[model samples]
Target: MSLSPLPLGGAAPSATRTPSRSAALALVFGAFVLAGCATEPPPPPAPAIPQYTSPIPASALVGRYGLAAYHRPQDATRTETQARAQCSNPYVITDGPNGGVMMYLADDTKLTEVISKQVPGQPTYIGPAEDPAGGERDRQVISFNGTVLQLKWVDPEIAKRYGIMVYVRCP
Candidate 1:
């Protein structure tokens, strides 16, 4: 395109003076931020502890016990909803470094399809430790005498089948 003549000895404005995209976006963003500043929402309030906890029970290891809950995938689809809900095992105390008792929580519990019947070296089809239980495989007891709680996974194949883990503890 042909350029227009200069006016009163002033040089002709260059066509290269077009604004950059980032400059345009910054201008628009600044206007938007200024508009939002006029109507900013108030900050959230502090969390309120319940007053019903009048007298707190004192335990040397209450906080030490990790909170355990089912961590299976949420039933979102029709197929997953039809499947059984996995169970989560609670915390247990075991000897840690320096002979201290370390509380551990087990969360992941999933049902995997049984593929093989027997291994090369194994004799039996599968032992109690590797077998899924009969009727829950449920039957258990938790004995806590205000201090130490003995939790033994009693039901046959409960630990083996469900894959009870103890890696992650409660926050």
Candidate 2:
């Protein structure tokens, strides 16, 4: 048998195949792509907060009020009378450290600072500063005259439990 010279830049003949430069580079690039994806994505942007300034000032609502709770709208008028009678053991609303009022939240015994907030074309709401107007912890102002103030909880379950709150200003 006669022997021939091998071609230059050509891999020697072998049982195992040698990877090309492009194939090796592609493997390295794929590893980099996977490594880049391993890290978590950036957090979502914060929500825009609306301006909350009530037409009815907090100072106007500060006082001792005879409080009553009723379910039906029809019962509101009657509830006012009951609320007036409860003046003996009234619900007290005091001035907060800031301009807000201090009152008890739904199902809470400790008094919390409640802000009166009104959005454009929306009913006024009362809740802690952390919550938005008409939020879960907030209560919509049903009605407020010089002597009477009515509030309904924004949360239906809480409204059902607490009922419509009627506050008749004590003399």
Candidate 3:
């Protein structure tokens, strides 16, 4: 084997020359380009949760009542799609876990506990409940007295998705 001193120092130039600054730069840039083109799917959208502006108090829930009217927006946008409205049948909340409240359909034999709002001033909120048996997620209803009288969904999207409404109403 032949030995030779490198032009810059004591080492021989490698069979594979070190890439020039521009070549290295191009390789780095190319790597970024390839990364950008990678097929990694975008993260799924977060669940849309409705915010009840005014939560009806527990005192109001302990009686037989009719759903005067209600709706779920086409989407949560400020103004996008027209809402779907319905006049619901009667339901009731006569008791609860601890002094809370329990709700049930006019004819339903099972009863669900009314969870208090985790956030102060938020209407009747439910879910993210724990079931050791791991039960299904539930939808929440927010009741309030208004010109139209609303049993509004706290999270309209979640309610529709689960096919469950936390409130008790003749369905």
Candidate 4:
């Protein structure tokens, strides 16, 4: 091949020029568009647990007691005497692993940790951990006078089946 004279600029002469700047600009623009479209979504909020305070502490109720179940509100007084007679086979309440009390849920034989809670305009209740006061499985403290404690389940069906619970403290 014969040698040719050089042009004024240092660029070489070619049949087809490569559009370097435009190609790179197009690639960069595409990357930005894709990045904008593919951005990650914000994470969901965490679950909230409610907090409550109890006027009556669990320690006050932890002890051996005779238990009786009665259907009517008037029968509660009568059941207290029956519960007192049941001291031979007492229902025991003990301190829980945590700073709560250990008691049996409705229809459950196994003991579970329960927290006492007092809500405004509502009676005191004891229920499972993390549950709201007067929850379905909770038991409302109808009355507790150091000697006798009356509890009624929050669930209507359970209340009908188990009735009002009377716990008479044993000597």
Instruction: Write down the RMSD of candidate 3 (Cα, Å).
Output: 13.1
Could you give the C-alpha RMSD of every candidate to the true structure, in order shown?
A: 20.0, 3.7, 13.1, 7.0
> Model 1, which residues run further than 4 Å from truth?
1-37, 51-58, 62-143, 147-171
For model 3, residues 53-128, the per-residue Cα lDDT tens digits are 3244556556654433223443332111111122234455576665546754223477766443444543344433
lDDT of the structure predicted as candidate 1: 0.34
lDDT of 1 by residue, 1-171 (tens): 987778443656776675667889999999999999989798898655222211112222233333222223341232222221221443433433332233322232632221111233322111122243212322122233443322334344555444322122223
lDDT: the better of candidates 2 and 4: 2
What lDDT score goes with residue 3 in model 3? 60
- Residue 47 deviation, candidate 2, in Å? 3.4
Q: Please give, for residues 1-171, the per-residue lDDT of candidate 4 as tens digits.
A: 997876545567778966677788999999999998899878888656567777668888899999999997788778889999999999999999987899999878899999889777778898985888889989998888888888899999999998899999999
List residue ranges in candidate 3 displaced over 4 A: 1-56, 68-89, 105-109, 120-143, 146-158, 161-171
Clash tally, candidates in order: 0, 0, 3, 0
Cα shift from native, residue 50, model 3 (Å): 21
Query: What lDDT score belongs to each candidate, Candidate 1 first?
Result: 0.34, 0.89, 0.43, 0.87
Which numbered prediction scores highest in TM-score against the true structure?
Answer: 2
The lDDT leader among the candidates is 2
- On a 0 to 100 scale, what is the lDDT of residue 123 in model 4? 84
